[model samples]
Target: MDLFWRYGFATLPVLVFVSFYRMGDVLTLTLSHPLWNARGYSLEAISMADGAVALFASMAGVAIGGWIAARWRMGWALVIGALASAIGNWVFAWLWDTPLADGSLYLAAGIDQFGHGLAGAVFVVYLSMLVNPRYPAAQYAFLSGFAFLLPRLVAGASGTIQKVIGYDGFFVMSGALSLAAVILLPVVLRARSRPSDQPEPAA
Candidate 1:
């Protein structure tokens, strides 16, 4: 279990990637305020978009994300997923100004939900790969839990940040959080190309 955190930290960038992998997802936490209070989007609009539209859209995203990873590699899926989440936040920011009757709300909701679905599928697979078959449960818990650690902490301040900067600024800030993944991608990819710290081989 400690390997995920304790492995050769100096040489391996895995810890950094692991920590920042889903950082942009915190944006989802900030969404309710802008959509509900700031924008006055109705619960009916929320249901219409998050219910049927999200169901199909998220399903499609998961399928496509899986296909992309299969066709090229897992990294591509991760990169795309990170970008999707960031872009989704930006769309929501823009949607804040859109009139609800214009149906733009549905489009923004679909994009955000689809991104979550896509990111979630690949992220689970990636986390599983990082686990040891010997102690999969504990190791996976650490990695998965660690991935959200910083995001959850940062999310504590989300409301304050939004109030100070306004909805659009807050959304953009959330989208900008993707820079963590983007900036670290090269190092993470390089680390992947090399041998990863893994479970000891069976005798």
Candidate 2:
């Protein structure tokens, strides 16, 4: 029940919201004229390339994250995902501006895609863990609602924030936020792992 509630109801919505917002932002950028110029690539070509990259990258991310989650606890998986996301964002924000070949962007895009994938997988696993088998339907519905709403609430401001900060600053901030998430993992895991009714299990 706890796992279901946490992951299914709580985490799913957040991940969905973030995914939607991220997709929208990427789409907007891919279609925008200025971004194309900034990248020294044609708008149509870049847009096409970006779309393709996002597709593959997200799929890959989800796969890897899911794999990791299956072997590890949700907290650990989330921690890893958060760290990867931070690193990817940092690279995108800082290193992306360097004069590199087109292949470089593709590689960077792949890394970002992997990060997102990992996040998605971790979220799914966590939510799954939260769902209680007894009241699966009700709990799932509750989680589903959050899955639908929170992203919009949190990610809605992303555009405005990005505008104010610019890509570099925004990436840095996002990375920092991700790191903060990572930092919380140990505390959360410790609490979760603490002995309950039964005496503490021998380590």
Please report the candidate that would top lDDT against the real structure: 1
Pairs in clash, predicted candidate 1: none
Backbone clash total, candidate 2: 19
Clashes per candidate, residues 3 or more apart or on different chains: 0, 19
lDDT of 2 by residue, 27-57 (tens): 2232233433566765555565478977888
What's the lDDT for all of these models? Answer: 0.71, 0.58
lDDT of 1 by residue, 1-203 (tens): 34533444533466567666666666565554455545776778777877897899889888977777677677777888788878877887788766666378778778877887777777788778666566789888887888888788888888788789878787777877864576776666554322445657789
How well does candidate 1 match the true structure in TM-score terms? Answer: 0.85
User: What lDDT does candidate 1 reach at residue 8?
Assistant: 41
Candidate 1, 165: how far from true, in Å? Answer: 1.3
